[model samples]
Target: MSISRRTVLGGLAAAPALAALAACGGSGGGGTTEITYGYIPDFNGASLLAIADDRGLWEENGLKATLQTFTNGPLQIQALGTGDLDFGYIGPGAMWLPASGKAKVLTVNGVGQADRVIAQPGIDSLEALAGKKVAIPEGTSGDMIVQLALQSAGMSLEDVEKVAMDPSTVVSAFSSGQVDAAGIWYPMIDNIKQQVPDLVELAQNSDFADVMQFPNVMVTSATYPEENEATTLAVLKVLRAAMDVRAEDLDTTVELTAKLTQQDAEAVAADASNGQYYTAAELDALVGDGTVETWLTAMNEYFEENGKIEGETVAPADYFTFDLFTEAGK
Candidate 1:
């Protein structure tokens, strides 16, 4: 299932000439590939692309990456399909749609504890969420985490009143007593606690243990990588190096995320300690073998079981392109 620029333009197949028009404007114009890097302003590795840009690593690597912030991952995904965003530091669950066909995965940049499941004063457990309304962004990693978290309580999304909203709104909705609970991402999780001191902590995504993984990955348009291999490799090199820099300097990383997300640096640093970061060797191994495919397969099935994705389940390998990562490593 190949997705061309015409397919990405969405129903513009009738205008075949537009494809030629886009190519002339998109990097074929004889300059560094002007990359619009999309990211959710969460205090996680996904947002670290902003740090890479802020530190001028992208430029240092011979590419120009423009940082575009999003309120949530789904919006970021939408931009990817329409070609509004050429590159993204996106989450695994949302990465599924593009990984399915629309784009190529450079690598799973980092896995972290980004999402949070918080309840109102009276709702304290996953069981309490069964009949009550729960706010979360549909088709996102946080959505998957919450779905699996419900299973541990012997329930699924069917048992609850699921209100799909943007992560930007979920926190406000949960804090203002509009929803019983919200499965939102970080910084928002930190924001909620500060705004509503009485909000109850139902579960963290990590509480589900091995049943869930909220991974952030780098992705490019399916054709983009093949057409601009050198530029793609440059992007990956900068990101992998950026992760190493992040590990060596926590306070600066937190400050970068805080500045980008507009949250307090201390709050970002304090709550940021919970998620896992991948090592270079660990990332290489995951990309080199079937481990990521295995995770994506599990994620796909989880989505299908929860009715988040329609039709027969797609294979995980279709959603990724490991050769790019392998090339970057070389």
Candidate 2:
């Protein structure tokens, strides 16, 4: 669960190797439908992978799913852009960056809540971060969450000394009193709070309703979905089954997630039942109402206003295609 800073930084350099692994064929038997799946080793994706592997859902669906691990979303997107991955779980923000023509990928199904943000002890207000160093991985969901949280307090990134650090480093920074706060996700967030008993969650996705629903989405290369719609549908079917499994059996789901995240089973169960997982119906509504698009546009506008876009405009819809999910629904 504790990833080293060196590993996080190494991802940028290991993009080629990760992409190569993603491009490799599945390990299933002869004539089986092979589909590569890329995921970060987090609680959310880990749960799904555990269930799919344990329950043999992929095999049951005739899908030889090859689960590939990536260090972060950017690298995952990079591999996805190169046709290295057929499908993967990634943050919507990561999809937004590449959807601007930097990468060739499309969103399939929205998976879980964006329950990640800045946690600081005794920082009852965002103003507390003013002049204090706050840690975040640049150009990531955590970064965006921190930005939006600051905006909610009528403040901006300029209010704090932004420390561009990965999730792993954030913990060490906070532990050493080198940073005032860290924008991070579960397992890390839970782990940090436990270590620093005084640490408090300052901001989270729930703080911003519009952005809160920005779930982790299942994505694939544009070409794969275009040329292999059936296969894409089949994959969705497997995911849908996994979702159902999660809903029907909470204890089992939590145990599997714990095994994958290497966290306590009780803690994992608490997080699982914590309203992070989304139902298929809820995901459908998000897609139908252009909720994802609107959220992306808002994020794009934020990036642009903050001068992160750098003389370029990104179209949100370009990063997503509800066709596969729609087909699966039918």
Candidate 3:
């Protein structure tokens, strides 16, 4: 279950190579900081950082950054665990691991009701869902959301056959008729519906879950941040710049994500609307006001309650920090 760097790299060959790590640092001295930043290709949390990469903001800040896309947060976190990644955009499941002790949350990337349970056509109700297979990404927030919707229908997860796989694989599995139902996120939901026009929505995550956030949090190896303070500040500044665009020019934001991911622009827009976007000042308040902490603590409890992780829980503040944002502003 513990994924080593070699184990993860074989699956994610698109990422920057090990040779690339030797070249990290500012370009001012004939060497640019070589950073491998990872994110999911899904519509929600990656747009801002993609915008930054597209705009050459990382380079402008004197860093040679490679933005690698992954299947899910845990894959990226696995890369982080082996030091293959200097920074990563992670979800709640992966975040819990790093948030506890391995990595540090630089800032919450994006938050929203980003999960949904989509079923094959003519299967309109939960009653139809029983005995059918429900595919979801193992250990991610979408897994929990799917379970909540099943519970709302008066059914436990045991009532149905649960299939655990990567969300990306589930999408392909659904299209191939390998799965009867799939718990997925937009634009995957949107993408699947386009491919299989008869798919039906069994439940919307927004209806049953109060604080279900498909958060892509920016994080670094815990020691990496402390050792490279200036570099961390620079990275955050570029990210802060990208998020500023999400706040100011959302249409352009959607267009960029759609173009880069080859997803529908409308689906991207719909997903973006479900969440609250953050600016630098707003991030300060979210962290300072304890809003971020409360959300993370809830995630930890929910995961623990579900038996995903078996251990004592730590405070949310243990996993998150606002120092880079604070220093970026100054």
Query: TM-scores, in order shown?
Result: 0.77, 0.80, 0.78
lDDT for each residue of candidate 2 in 1-330, tens digit (9 for 90 to 100): 524211222364122212111212222432457767777655554566677777877766667766676766656656777877777766645645444555433443333443465555677777788888888876666776788888888898889888998667887777767888777766566667666777877877667875544555666765676787767777776777777777678689878867765577876665554345655666677778987667667766666765665335757666555656756766
- Deviation of model 1 at 155, angstroms: 1.6
Candidate 1 TM-score versus the reference: 0.77
| Residue lDDT tens for model 1, 245-310 | 677776788887776666667766765675677655677887677777776777666666656564
Q: Over 4 Å off in model 3, which ranges? A: 1-11, 17-34, 41-46, 54-56, 59-62, 122-124, 166-169, 172-179, 194-198, 209-211, 255-276, 310-312
Candidate 3 per-residue lDDT, tens place, 131-188, comes to 9999977666567677878878888889999998876788798988888997776656
Instruction: For model 3, name the residue pairs that clash.
Output: 24-34, 25-32, 25-33
lDDT scores of the candidates, listed in order? 0.65, 0.64, 0.70
Ten contiguous residues with the weakest lDDT in model 2: 15-24
Off by over 4 Å in 1: 1-33, 45-47, 54-56, 82-84, 121-124, 176-178, 194-198, 259-263, 310-314
Residue 135 in model 3: lDDT = 92
Task: Report how far off residue 257 is in candidate 3 (Å).
Answer: 4.3
Rank order (by TM-score, best first) = 2, 3, 1
Model 3 lDDT on a 0 to 1 scale: 0.70
Give the poorly placed runs of model 2, Cα more than 4 Å off: 2-31, 102-122, 259-264, 270-275, 306-314
Candidate ordering by lDDT (highest first) = 3, 1, 2
